[model samples]
Target: MSNLIRLIIGFALVGAAVALFIFGHWGWGLLAVFFSICLFVTYFYNENMLIAQWYLRKDNMDKAAVFLGRITNYETQLNRMQHGYFNLLIGLIESRTAPMKSEKYFKAALNLGLHMDHNIALAKLSLAGIAMAKRNKREAQMYLADAKKADKNKLLADQIKQMKDQLGMLDRQTQVRYSHR
Candidate 1:
């Protein structure tokens, strides 16, 4: 349906431009046609980006990666597509059973050359979570602190604060238990 609408609108604009040229209003018609073309291109790119993001968020990492890879090929100059690719890599990392593979994905995301605040924060948080899982308190704290510094969302800020507090408590508990041994 949307494709049909786009087709209709495209033809309508072209027809209007032709009509205007025939009626001696060529300048306005040409401008309208140019603007319409620009609008269509922008909309197409944004729609593809949104689809990539949706697939990534849904945990369909393979599909998301494919889509994002296609987008990157289609728009070589668009850095935002790398953001989508990084997010898919993050998802892939989170799904891995092995810490080494997970770390690889996290590092791959970092190497993507795109550093939106949220994406960077998410990568840091993922690393922090992995550190916590491995009982590496110092590494977790470092990642958590980086995540906190990269925070763009106040809610995420609060969540990170709570996570740090929980991690601290866990560390204290571990120390106490080991000390009693």
Candidate 2:
């Protein structure tokens, strides 16, 4: 189901829990609370991620951030793989405005293990971009090398090429600056 429908159902379950408590059905109320909490947790864990990813795919940053922002208590509730994906999504979102912050999220996702070469490669590419932005040429080169290795399908070949060209241009610019000094 869609995230909106799941959110509505979750709210409804919370209301049911409260109604059961008011009607003196203590046991049922407790059960309702448990189920509601489970539903909420499940909703927080899965639905937002799916919806946010869809928005991200469409390059709708505002919509994607809105969905992703709905998820709470990331560190405690999410499992290892889920946490990785969560960090990856957050990293992607932050990459445009705060690349330094995005780099940390991407690294965390990588350390936690995405288990998908394509995702790992993408994260690596983001890291390379961040490194390049920071003028960390060595780090950027390392990340690019890692991304190249992980991109078995060559899906990111164009991106890799662009970054490589940019890196070369930056290197030449730095070389000229140093030589002039």
Candidate 3:
């Protein structure tokens, strides 16, 4: 189900729980509350992710960050796939501000297993960008290769080609500089 639908259902459950409590049905009210809490835990990360993506699509980085930040202790609350996506979201957002920190998040997401070729490719491509920025040509090349392999849909073809061209240029420049010395 969509996050919006889940959120509506959760709110309904909470409202019903409150109504039941007010009517003095203690047992049913407590049961409703328990179910509502479970639903909240399930939907919290999903809803935040949806909102964060919307903000990101609008280029509202600050707003996106705020929404993403609302998903606290996600490692425990979320399932494996969600946990991986949570880290991926954090990595993508943080890569703009704190690059070094983003690397760890990306790696964590990868280790947790994204389970999608596109997502895995994206993470690897981001790692390649990080490696390139740090002037680690070999590491960048490794990541680029992995990204290419993981991109079964060829969604990252343009980016892979661009990075390859950049790496080639860097290699030529390095060779020329060394030869002139």
User: Distance from true position, residue 70, model 3, in Å?
Assistant: 0.6
Query: What tens-digit string does per-residue lDDT give for candidate 1 at 29-134?
Result: 9986986685566444445555667876796766765655654543343445455444435455355545545765676666664457877787777778778877
Q: Report clashes for each candidate as comma-separated counts.
A: 0, 0, 0
Each candidate: what lDDT? 0.68, 0.87, 0.87
User: Candidate 2 on 136-161: residue-level lDDT in tens?
Assistant: 99999999999999999999999999
Model 1: weakest 10-residue lDDT segment is 71-80
Query: For all the candidates, what are their Cα RMSDs to the real structure?
Result: 6.9, 8.8, 7.5
TM-score of candidate 2 on Cα atoms, chains taken together: 0.74
- Where's the lowest-lDDT run of ten residues in candidate 3? 72-81
The TM-score, computed over Cα atoms with residue i paired to residue i, of candidate 1 is 0.59
In Å, residue 170's CA in model 3 sits off its true spot by 1.1
